[model samples]
Target chain A: MEKEICISELKRLSHLYDIEITVAKKAGRRWSYIVNAGEEKFLPSQIVDQFEGYALFVEGKDFDNEAVVNAFRKIIKKINAQKGG
Target chain B: MITESSWIKKVIKEEEYKKYMNGEKDFINDDEIMQKIEKNKNPDPSKIRNIMKKSLEIQTLSPDETASLLNVTNPLLWEEIYETAAKIKKKVYDNRVVTFAPLYCSNYCVNNCLYCGFRRDNKEEVRRRLTLEEVKRETGVLAGKIGHKRLIVVYGEHPLSDAKYIANTIQAIYSVKAKTKNGYGSIRRVNINAAPMSIEDLSMLKEIGIGTYQVFQETYHHETYKKVHPSGTLKSNYQWRLYSMHRAFEAGVDDVAIGALFGLYDWKFEVMGLLYHAIELEKRFGVGPHTVSFPRLTPAKNAPYVQKTKYKVSDENFKKLIAVIRLSIPYTGLIVTAREPARVRNEVLPMCTQTDASTRIGVGAYSLWGKEKEQKLNRQQFLIGDDRELDTVVRELSEMGYITSFCTAGYRCGRTGKNIMELLKSGKEGSFCKLNAILTFREWLDDFASEETKRAGEKIIKREMEEVKKSATRAYSPQVVEELENYYKRIKNGERDLYF
Candidate 1:
C-alpha cells in the first residue's frame, strides 16, 4: 500500500531531530520540503540522496518512519561533525 | 523648534515600554554595583587567573569577576591578562580583524547631548542628511573604490532620520553595485548605529534585512545620563534606552549591539555597567549583544564637555579596560574604532575583533574628499584620531600577521542572532569564519589592494589557507572543503563576494 507523506508527518520527524521543516507549495499541489538546522538548510530529497540505500523516500506516498529517522540521524551527524563536536 | 511635549508624544511609544518593563523596573542596580566594586578591593591573583581561564572557555564573567578585573593594578598580572585576552579572541574569532567604514547619514540631531558636535543647539555645526541618491554615491565609493564589505551607518535622533528614511537609505546603499578593478562590489552588510525605536518601528528595519541594530547607553550612570541628555527630551528616559535591545529582540532583530561612551562617568563603573547590561539581556532574552563598542569621547568643535570631563580615561587605563572587556565577555565581539590614534589601534588590534578603516564621520565626506582635504569638525560629530586610508591599514595589519577580513557571510547564511551566539561560544564560529575570511581576502586583494598591500596580503592568505586545510579537514565534510576550494579558485580568478 502506498502511503501519502503529509506535512504533519514530516513536521513530526523534524521535531524528533530538532530541525525545522517547512512545506510550501511549489507549483499547484506540489510541496517542497525545507529542512533547517540552525543557519544551514537541506532539501529533504538531498538528505535522502546523501544516505543512499536507506529506503528513505521524499516523493513517495507512504513514508517509512524508520528510514526517515535513519536519514535524519545521518544529517545530524554531518552537522555536528562540522561544528567540531 | 517644535514644542517638547508634542515631539515626545509623537516619538515615545509608552505602551511599548510598559509591555517590556517589570512593575518595580529594577533594570540597573547602581547602589549594588558601587557596593560590589567597593567590596572586591583586592582580588586574589590565583582566583583572578581562574576567572581568566573561564573566559578562555568563552563564558561570560559575572559582574563581580569583571569588577575584580577592573581593579587589577599589578603590572605583571596585567600583562598576563592582556596575553589571555588575545588568546581568547584568537580561540573564538581567529586572527582576523573584520573591517568596516562608518557612514554618517545625517547630523541633524534632536537631542542636545553635552559632548556631541551634532547637537541641535550647536550653531557652528552644519547639519545635512544624505538623500537616497547621495547614499548610493557614498556607497559606490566605499564598496567600489575603497572596497569595504560592511558599514556601520550612523544616524541622528531626529524625525528626518526616522525609521522610514533609514530603510530607504539602506535600500539605496544595497542597490549600488559599483565597478571595481576586476569585478563588481557592493556593501554586503549594513549595521545601524542609530537612535532606539519603538518595537513597531524596529520591525520595519527587520523587514528590510538590516544587520546588527546598535544602540548605546552613552552613560550607564543614571545621574550622568540625566545630566548629559537633559530633561524633557526623548533620550532623557534612561530605562527606554537601557531596554532598547529588548525592543529590538521583540521586533525580531536577530543581532543587537550595546556600548557606553567612556569619559562620561567613572570608567570602572562604566565597564561594570556594560557587564550588567549583557547579563540582563541574557537573563531576559536568552542571548546577549552580538558586539560591544566602547568609543572614548574625543573633542568636538563646540562640545565643551569633551575637554572638561573629570573621568577622562588615560591611555594606559584605556588599554587595561579594553583587555578587561575582552576577558569579561569573551564570546561577544569587542570593537575598537578609529576614534583612537593609529598607534593605540595597533596596540589594541590583537585584543579586539573589529575596527573601522578609511573612516570619515562627516556627512557626505567621502564624496567631498577631493574638494575637502581636511575634516571640518563642525561637519562631523567628533574628530577622528585615525584617518589612515584602507590600504595602509590593511598593509599594517598584514605586516602584524593579522588578516583584515571583509566577510559578511555569517549574517546572510543564517549564522546570526542566536545561532551565531551558540557557535561563537562553542568556538565553532571561528572555523567557518576563517574559510570565509580567506575567500574574501582574496577578493579584496584582487580588487582594491595597493601594490605593497597586495604583497603583504598574499602572504597572510597563504598562511590562512594552510591553517584552514589542516583544521577544517578534521571538522567539516569533504564536500565543504571541495566547495571552499572551488570558491577560493574563483576568487583568485577575480571573482568577488565569494563566501563559504
Candidate 2:
C-alpha cells in the first residue's frame, strides 16, 4: 500500500540531512522528490522500490528511523560510486 | 570630479564578496592540490593509458590522473598522448577550426600587476578606453571588412569599464551591420575577457545577452599571485577572483571561461591547477569551463618581468602541455591565441579547437589600421606573434583540409550551460555543429572570402558535404537535409547568415 507524504516532512528531512530537496510533478497529479548534494543528483522514489519498507518511510507512513537511514546510505553510496570513489 | 578612490569604492563591493565566501574560505585548496601532485609523482604507463581511455570517452579526468599525464616523459608515450589528444579534439569538436578576433576595448587598469603592460603604475603605456561609438566603428571593420563572426573583447579592470559600460559596449557591437560582397556582415557572438564582477553586476550583463564570461586566474600559485598583484589591490584578493565563476553561475550566466598565464609558474603545476579547477566546477555545479586558454608570457615595453621570467615554457614543453590539457578535459574548448608565432601555432593547431587571427591588442586598432600596423608595445597589452590577416589564415586552414567555422547557432539554439555539456559528452553536439558549420562557411565564402581563398575553400566544402551526407544522415533528417541544401545554394547566390 502507498501512503502520501506531506511536503513539510520532506523539507524537514532535507534540512536535517543538509541536502537540497525539490518536488516536481512527474506526470499528471504524480509527484517526485529530487535529492541533490552539490552536483550529485538522485531520486529517492526510484530506489525506494529496491528496499523493503523504504517506500513507506519515504511517504511518512512508517516511522522506522533505522530503515530510513539505511535507505539514504544506500543512495549516497551509489552516487559516490558513480563519482569514481 | 570623480576621484579614483571613489571609483574604486564603487567597483569592489565588500558585502557581495562576503556572501559567496565559505566563512573566510572558498574553493582552490592549494595544499590539497600540492599533496595530490606529490603523491602521484611516478605513475605507471598502464595506468596512464587507462586514464587516457577515460578521456577518449569524453569524461573529465580527475586531478590525480591529470598529474600523472603531466609527469609523462617517455618519448614514445608522449607521441601516443599527442595522437590521442588530436583524436579527442576531432571526436568532440569535429574537424572545424573556429576563429575569432581579439578586440581590446580599454587599457585603463586599476591594479599594478608586475607582468602586464596595462598595470596602473606603468607610465609608458598609453591609457585609453573606447566610447560606444568607437566600439561600433571597430566592430564595423571586424565584421564587415575582416569577416570575423566572433570576438573576445578584452578590458582592463577599472571603473570606467564597469558592468554597465560592458553591457553598453556589447550592445553597440551587436548593433553594427556592415556591407559585404554578397550580403550583410555582423558580429554574431561577443565573448568577454575582463575582471571579475559581483553577482548583481553579472546578472545585469546576463540580461543583455552576453556570450561566455571569461576571467583568467593569471596564476593559480598563491604566493606568485600575491607577488604579482600587490597587496591592498582588487586583484590581490585571490579568493574573490577564484570564486568569480561560482558567482557568475549563480547570476544566471551559462558559459564561463578559465585560464592561467604560463611562465608565471611551473607549467606542469599550472596544468594540474587548471584540471583541479575544472573538476571542482563539475563537482559543485555539474558544468566545467566552456574554454581553457594557455597564453604564454610575451614581451611588453616596460614590463620587464615578462622577458625575465625564470619559468618560461619552451616550445617543445608548450606543445606537450597543450596536448595534456586536451586529453585531460576532452569536452572543453582549448584556445591557442596569436601570442605564439605562426610556426608554433601550426605545430599545436591539431590539438586546439580555436585560435585568433588578425588580432589587434590595441584599443581602436581595427579602426586605426594603417597607423597601428607596427606592433607598438606601449599601446598594446602584449605583442602578438601572428599578425597574418584573416584571409591568409582562411587560405591556410583550407589548404590543410580543415573547415573554418563561424557558427554561433549552438548558443542561440539553447545548446548552452548544462545542455551543451551533455550534448558534447554524448558526441551529438559535433553532428549538429557540422551541419551549421557548413551553412556558415558557405555564407562566409560568399560574403567575405577573397577569390584565391574561395577557390581553395570550395574544394573543402564539397568534400565536407560528401562526408555529411555519408555519415550524418540520421542526425539531419531528409527534410532538414533538403532545407540545408537550399540554404547552401542561397548563400552562394547572395544570401547570408543562414543557419539551421
For residue B446, model 1's alpha carbon misses the true position, in angstroms, by 0.3
Show where candidate 2 strays beyond 4 Å. A1-85, B14-23, B370-372, B472-476
TM-score of 1: 0.87
Task: At residue B404, give the lDDT of candidate 1.
Answer: 89
Clashes of each: 3, 0
List TM-score per model, in order.
Answer: 0.87, 0.84
TM-score of chain B of 2: 0.97
Estimate, for each residue in B187-229, the C-alpha lDDT of model 1 and write its tens digit.
9889899998988888888777788899999888988888888
Write the residue-wise lDDT of candidate 2 on B1-500 in tens digits.
77777877666666665675678765666787788778887789998899889999999888888888888878889898999999898888888899999999999999888899999888989889999999999999999888999999989998888888898898899899988776678988889998989889898887677778999998888888888899978899887788788888887677889999999988887888788788878887788999999999998767867877899999999999999999998999999989999899988999998999988888889997656677888899888999998888988999988888998765553456776687688776677667777888888887778999999998988988888766643354454556668878877777776665
lDDT of 1 at A62: 35
RMSD of each: 7.5, 11.3
**Residue B260: error of model 1 in Å?**
0.4
Task: Give the winner by TM-score.
Answer: 1
